[model samples]
Target: MRRVQRVPLDEAARQYLCERQQYARRLLAEDRLRAARFWKDMRETAVFTPVLTALEQMAGPRRRCMYCLDSRGSDVEHFRPKASYPHRMCSWRNLLLCCSDCGRKKGDRFPLDDQGLPLLLDPSADEPWEHLDFDPETGNLTPRFDPTGASSPRGEETVRMLELDQREELALGYQTTYKRLKRELEVALSAGPLDPSALRERLEEADDHGLLPWCLRYGGSTLAPFSTLRQEHPAVWAALSEAV
Candidate 1:
């Protein structure tokens, strides 16, 4: 998963949103129409744009959910439930671009810390790899161990809330992407003295969810072909890692 930069709303769109947020709040008080209109506007502007871009940027070019690092993201997810936090309904940082499968599984459940900060890291606001880790051989996602080596709290919650480790399709998707990345690296290595910039661009273009960052920054360094590159060609590995 990655952090996505939110699109700045134009004056017109911005004003419209402010007005609508109030309108929805009023309607919500009466328990009618607000949900529909909110959904309507959300769909119309397609909240996915900024949300997706943020995910792309933060996640490295491999655009999987920050939580699962699987599934090709297809929806803008709300880190905090919009219904519960109307105050942040139009807040860009509160949104996440995720797959429908993750969205459905995560529906409206906002797990929080004792102090009330969200347990799930905001992909847009934080570097998820800091709180999470990937298991390459098995392709399972889990919390990153801390300096003392215990699983990270945020990572554990993110995994449970999004069901990252349990989703069959998500696991399969990550597995496929991982294999493809490995295969590509092997081909590049065979070519000898690979151009890191050119290869990075090529990989970025090929990535479906703009997931090149994760590959270069995290997945590439830890996994095969990538591991081979790191072991056999430090300069190339450094170049690729630095590019992200």
Candidate 2:
């Protein structure tokens, strides 16, 4: 998953959400809140339409799932399960765009640490690569190993929660995106001195699965053609990484 920059809602949309939150709060106080019914009503509102559009825009042209970044995001997913956290049901920050598969798999299963912090990665709030690692060979996502040789708990939980390692179709999609990026880098390398802006544009276009960040910032640095670029062209690598 990529780090999704949460976009701000316009004044009108923000006001609508604030009103919805007040309604949700009232229902919750009376213990009469039903998450499904509340969301169904909210979904029918004109203001809610803009919220969905904003989420789609955040997912780019494909509008891929926020959790997997694979498959089309067709529905609004509750980051904090609405059933469990009714107060946040209408909260803008608690919503995300997700695919049906991910929605089904993640249904109401919110795990938390001892401190009551969520164990699952929040793409909009956290950098996934910090906890997760990619295997270029197997095309599976796994927990990054820490300096102490223990797998990152958050990464492990996220992978397990999303079944990132077991899904065949997801792995294939990630592999395809990785190869496309690799090929682009190889072609750029063969063409001598790099034009920083041009290379950035090309990589951004090719990065459908959000692997570019992983390549430049994390485990991908040790892998080729990234490794070759880093060693053979330090200045270019620096410039490219910075631009990305």
Q: Best candidate, TM-score-wise? A: 2
lDDT of 1 at 145: 81
RMSD of 1: 4.2
Per-model TM-score versus the true fold:
0.77, 0.97
Model 1: lDDT to the true structure? 0.67
CA displacement after TM-score superposition, residue 32 of candidate 1 (Å): 8.5
lDDT per residue (tens digit) for residues 1-244 in model 1: 6555554555565665567667777877787745535765765775434444554555555566644556666676667778778666766556566767778888888888889888887766777777767666556666778669688789899888877677666666666666766677788889877888877766655554324455666644666667788889888778877765
**Total clashes in model 1, counting residue pairs 3 or more apart in sequence or in different chains:** 19
Cα-lDDT of candidate 2: 0.89
Root-mean-square deviation (CA) per prediction: 4.2, 1.0
Model 1 Cα shift for residue 28 (angstroms): 6.6
Runs with alpha carbons beyond 4 Å of true place in candidate 1: 25-76, 206-223
Model 2 vs. true fold: TM: 0.97
Tell me the whole-model lDDT of each prediction, alpha carbons only: 0.67, 0.89
